[model samples]
Target chain A: MVIALCVTVALAIMPLVGVPKSWILYIFLFFIYLAMANMWNLLAGYSGLVSLCQPAFLGLAGYAMTIGTWLDIPWWAGMIGGSLIAGLFALLISSAVFRLSGVYFAIGTLVVPEALRMIFFLWRPVGGAMHGAGAGYMIKGIGDLSPHVVYWLSIFVGVGSLFLVKGILRSKLGLGLSAIRDNERAASSSGIDVFRLKLYVFIISAIITGFAGTIYYLYQGYIEPTATFNVRWTMTLLLATVIGGIRTVEGPVVGTVVVVFLYFLLARYAGYSLLIQGIILVGIMLISPQGIVGILRRSKFYDSIVKRMK
Target chain B: MIYGGDIITPILMGIMLGGLYALIALGLSLVFGVMRLINLAHGDFVVMGSYIGYALMRNFGIDPILGLIISIPVMFVLGFFIQKYLMGRAFAIASEIPLIIAFGISLIIQNAHQIIWTPLSRALNTPYSHMSFHIGERQFPVSYLLDFVAGILIMLFLRWFLKRTYLGMAITAASQDKRVAQLMGINTGRVYGYAFAIAMVSAAIAGVFLGMTFPFTPTSGISFLTIAFGTVVIGGLGSMLGTFIGGIILGVVQTIGGYLFGPASQMLLVYIIVLVILAIRPQGLFGK
Candidate 1:
């Protein structure tokens, strides 16, 4: 709670001093990524639904926002509207894809984006010949909000999502989710609505992911299929969530910060960054499969700090 | 504008492509059969194999066909070391951990290729690249015919080896029940290495065929990976015969979709068919 309060206060006040545009953009990007990582963790970590389809939902929301803005919808409403599109898509598709359990289910969902991207590439509605949602689509009245306002909007959405995931985990539904993840057959016999509950988590997770997509593109003021729907985005979030802590509540946030920090340092090197990040992922898995949180929890350094605190 | 003969073109071409696709998926099928571990880097290895071929042919001024001789053994050793050393550690961890590890391995390989090759697309530009024979108004590409023959030969060889060879039988036994096979005094670890090495052989061969068939770059792994999984899943995971069947099925789906729904829908249709198949039969057509 204190951490939350500090973050809220700091972000709330950071914009007043006329902070540089890039720093605001960095924090803004951080929030979106943090939210996404958390949502991915909720599905994969808690519910045992490891989906590469997160990018599909994210890209779907982005395009929906573009379409909404193209139709002159309010920016706020457009974000929500875009999220709804992603949620609905998930709702309709999950039943079919979820039939395949475990790794097959993961691969099944992975193909959806490739198929959809082809549709995006072939269909001329949004991106036209360029095979991406065009730059002409812009949110109405977005100009009135300063960059910091946009940044704070990201903060609100990001923190809200983490709380939402935390809220779910605290509730009975969360118990049901954990139950499903632990053992589906037992969960089913115990009278938990495993399919329905999974659907709910999936839709909710997609919505939050969709929201990130909307805010991300809205702030950037451009969208493209290659950029928006790229697998790199999924890899980034997956790496973050895995590195920070797969199942821990604070892991995704910690991971998002780590990734953003690394991005600032290594992104300029292009292919080298990818190679190093890949090495880091393998190294992390080899060294600590449970991730940074797991490492910290096990380390003597953390124990010493805790002993001193006590 | 839909000529009847044109239908045969996609069919013949897709069947040949399916032959090659079967080759691609078989490596994955072998690993999954023995270990139940999905090598997400399976496609990257194939691409890496292709890059090795590219380097050999470009730098040493060697023929594309002979390039496979060098690439195959090299890949075999690489796969052996990766399985014994890197992937060996993840086997003790959760099932998902290996998949993520493989993804990381894929990223490393792909970027490494990008760094070395500088993303300048390369293809085998031999005289036979476009050479084909016309048969009753339908032309068949000679290169594709050779690829199809190579695929069939490899499949036949795998079947023979499994039934006839001691090591192959050990691999089959190990795949069926590693613990039981272990009790029978079979060294499952070395068998896994052999199986992985064999899979690499297929991937290395497929890589050459792929370069000869199409223009390739460092990032071409994912597309091949998708097709490999698609074929494996469609053929029913763990079924060796099903890999070939699945490849043909996928090829037919792509070719027919292109002939009917425009060329862009070829890949889109492959995914759609797999999705529909999974929805209807999650265990796949022949998978138990």
Candidate 2:
């Protein structure tokens, strides 16, 4: 928690000394990275939904926020409303698609988001057609807020998301979720309501993702179907969670920092960037399923921390 | 508008186009059926095939059709190695990781293609490009008719191979149940690699045909991928016959959409069809 707070404070102060606007965008996206990784970890890592269609929820939040802005709601309110809208969509989808286990569920989830992207492309006014819809509201009072302020706000969201997730993990709901992940049949036999547990986690994951999406578009001042529903975003978040160490709290933050940093640095090169990212992922997954943080946790340095605490 | 020219021509053209789509999707379906790997780079192989065709023709004046004899085998070998080295391990991890890894490969290929070919579109540019028949009021491209026949023949041959050949049967068995097949003395990993290789061969051929039919560029495969995926899903998972029907439906849908809404909106409209179909039947039309 202290680490997260320090990271937030550092982000808040970075832009004052002549950092480029591109770096600020990168910083804003860094918080988004944290949120996305955690949300995915909650579902696939902890609860074992393993659904690959997290982008669909992101899309929902983006479109919902856009709709809210058009209706003259404040940006924050729009973001909250958008998050709720996305949660509803997740609930509706989880019931039908989550029936399949393992890869089938993952593939089903993937198809859902790709389909949603196409739907938005077809729906015109809903997705703002090809050019995409803007935030509809100009920033008025927030001009006094530096890039640091924007960065800190994003950090707060990321930290709050982590706590919310931590709380869920500590609750009875978390027990049910872990049980469902371990063995759905055994968990049901033990008197746990499996479907309800799955639904709760899936919805919670979407809600957090939606909140991130809403803030993302507000920061960018635009929303487009392709960008919002991008498969690349889903892949990035998944990589972060997996390579950071699935089913752990600190894993996502570590994973996101590495992956997001790589993305920002390499993204300018287009094709070369993809090659490097792909090789890195393939290498990581092959060598260590436990990921970087997982490996680190087992090391002597981390072991010493536990020894000291004891 | 009468005399068979206006309506028959477009419908005929659409059918041939649909045939091409089935050819490309065949590799996708086959790999998914047997290995359960999507080969996110399947489309990239198609892109590579086009470039190979373009290079052969541009540099050596080699016939585009003849160039396939070399490129197909080359791609097959490369794909075999990819499956053995890269994708083999990925199959053990959860499905999403492989997909993400494939996405990275796709990005690499996209850039590699950009660097090698430049980002500009290229075509086979053969003399037969202008060859077409005007039978009564209907116009037909000879190249397209040949493409259609080739697609059907390939599908029939694939069907025969899967049903008749010992290796093919082993592949099918492995796809159905790897552990059972392994228990039966089959090397599942070897079969998986071969299956993936064969799929890449199909994709390479489809790429040649795709370049012949339309201008080819690195980015062109992205939308084609959407359509191919839609057809695969609509036809049902791991079903070849279903892919054919799905491909045709996609073609007909796109043709009508283009007719009504113009080309600009055709992709969006086709994607909508895929979405609505999946919503209604999550298992897809031919899914078992």
User: In terms of lDDT, which candidate is strongest?
Assistant: 1
For model 2, residues A1-310, the per-residue Cα lDDT tens digits are 4555575667677777777888887778878888988999998888877777888887788777776666666667777888899999998877667666665566567667766776666664533323435222232233453555556668777878888888999999998888887788999999999888888888888988888876776676666666667777876797788777788877787788878788788777766665666666668777766678767876899877545533
Leading candidate by DockQ: 1
What is candidate 1's lDDT per residue for A99-218, written digit by digit as tens?
A: 878888888988988877777665545432232343233444567757766788789888898889889999999999988888899999999999899889899999999988888888
Q: Which numbered prediction scores highest in TM-score against the true structure?
A: 1
Candidates' RMSD to native: 2.6, 3.8
iRMS, model 2 (angstroms): 3.4
The CA lDDT of each predicted structure is 0.83, 0.76
What local lDDT does model 1 show for residue A231?
Answer: 74
* Interface RMSD of each candidate, angstroms, one decimal: 0.9, 3.4
Please give, for residues B1-288, the per-residue lDDT of candidate 2 as tens digits.
Answer: 112324555566677777888888888889889977666777787788888888888999898889989988898898888788877887776655666567656767776888788789888778886488776767777777666776787788888888999999999999999999999999999998898888888888888888887788886766566667877877876787788778777776777666666665665567677756666675679988
DockQ of each: 0.81, 0.44
The DockQ for candidate 2, computed on C-alphas, is: 0.44
